[model samples]
Target: MTHVPIRVGIGGWTYEPWRGSFYPPKWPIKRELEYASRHVSAIEVNGTFYSSFKPATFAAWRETTPDGFVFALKASRYCVTRKVLAEAGESIARFVGQGIVELGDKLGPLLWQFAATRRFDPDDIAAFLQLLPRTHEGIALRHAVHVRHDSFLVPEFVALCRAAGVAIVYAASADYPAIGDVSGDFAYVRLEDAREDEPAGYAPAALDRWADAARTLAAGGTPDTFPCVAPGRAPAVPRDTFVFMINGAKVRAPHAAMALIERLGAEPQR
Candidate 1:
């Protein structure tokens, strides 16, 4: 049995509610990342979406997390929220060069999230995808796109992502459409429908479903439960997978992530 790595995590660590709930009542706020990173295998850095960080800041982040813990950066809004994505070359260049290399081996994929109004234009998207650099400061870079518009739910859009070797973010949201099509070498998922009443964010049955889906993704198989624009699933080559708990009942995000990690046969940080 080939078991590829499946990292279950949540969005950024900082939240006023988490100060007392997820974190210890008397714990230092500065060490929140350290605590959160230990519990979850990866984190989607929402802060990077709005602003760039210095090399020293990224280095300090790398120092806080343990080895094998990954950090997925949200690509700057300057790169994706625009009338013409092809013209985002300069913004992409600036975003990529913003001292992200300091994260070194801890760096993961860059998530380029599109606005709900951003429609699918094959030529424009393909051009934008072409602008993404393969490497930055000698380290390899991977990219994922989260498109919210219903226009993107087409086979042509999936083919564009496949041709570009960029992953399509499988987001579970009430307002946004979820695509199960796999285009890149890895699978990235955002689970956004967590509940406040459930201790694990998701109920036991729902978590079980997600766990199974994640295992399938790790094996390079797309979940049949999610709507797919493409006809079939990706090849069954073992690959790394990232699943993040986001939005909904935000306070239970960490607990949901840890629960998923445990379901995947991995022990969460105590």
Candidate 2:
């Protein structure tokens, strides 16, 4: 079996609730990213979704994390929430040009999340996907689209992503449409819907189930665990998997992420 890389992490490391529990008590706020980096292989930067960050900030982030730690950035809403997808090229370029290259090899996929109101338009989506640069600052870039509307679950959309080599995010949530289509070379999953009452967000059995699903994904097979709207399964080609424990019980995300990492038999970046 091919040894596919599996990364498990939470949305962001700056949550106040994690200060005392996940982070050490009285730990310097400046060192939060450093602390979190020691426990997880990757982190999804949610702040970038709201605003663009400076190159120095990106450099600082890369410096704080240990080697091999990946940072998956949530693309700015300004780039994806526009009325005309074709007009978003400049905004997309601005977002990408704003120091993302500073992260260097630590940069993982860029997640382009669309609002629930954004319906599927083949031409519009195709144009937006085409605008995504294959490389940024001389480094290859990986793109993932997180579509919320059910209209995006069609086979045509899947084909578009496959052609563009953009991953279709496997979002697991009751409120959002979960599409388990594998359209790109890798798989990106957002495990949302965790329960606050559950200490680890997901029960042990559920974690085990997710681990099995991750293994299946690594082997290039789509797990039947979620609702797949696309026409067929992903080809059995070894691929990397990014599993993020987000939303739901936000406070438990770290624990859940760590549990998933353990289940995958992968070591944290410490």
Candidate 3:
């Protein structure tokens, strides 16, 4: 079996609560990414979802992180919030053109997260997927779509993602719809139910379940997971998995990520 790489991390490095706990005390704000990169193999850049960043900023981010670290950027709101998905080509282009390629190999997946109100429209989604560039400046770009609406829980939606080679984010949360379908060559998962009471954020049993699921995904088989609306066919090849501990009980997210990494036997920096 191929040893598929699995990266575990939190949404962002800069959080007030994590200052003294997750981050070293008296650590400079500017060096947060540098420190976080040493511990977690990956990080989801949530700031990009709110605003566009300059090329220099992206370059600086790339330079700060260590080698083998991955930064998954969230697509800007303008690119995904339009009433008509077909008309979002220019917006999407502008977002992608904004020095994202500067990250180079450090760049991982580009996450396109839709609002809960955004229902599933097959034609609209297909048009938007078509607009996604397969490559950015000759570098291959991976795309992941995170649909929050329950309307997206359909076989047609899964088929569209599979055909487009876009990964559908497996977001496990009680408040939001969780879809365990694997569509693309990679698996993107966001764990949103981390509890503050639990020392590791997630219960030990829950982490074990997720670890097993990650192993199965990396080994090229879809594990029988829950909260799935439509279970799609497995991919022909094994896939690398990116798992992020996000939202609920946000303060303990880093701890949760580290626990999962340890469970996978990926040594995290102390």
How far does residue 191 in candidate 1 sit from its true spot (Å)? 0.3
Report the poorest 10 consecutive residues by lDDT, candidate 3: 226-235
Model 3, C-alpha of 156: deviation from truth (Å): 0.5
Q: What are the clashing pairs of model 1?
A: none
lDDT of each: 0.90, 0.90, 0.88
What is the lDDT, from 0 to 100, of the residue 213 in candidate 1?
95
lDDT per residue (tens digit) for residues 7-43 in model 2: 8989999999998889989999988988898898899
Off by over 4 Å in 2: 1-4
Count the clashes in each prediction. Answer: 0, 0, 0
lDDT of 3: 0.88
User: Candidates' TM-scores?
Assistant: 0.97, 0.97, 0.95
Error of 1 at 249 (Å): 0.6
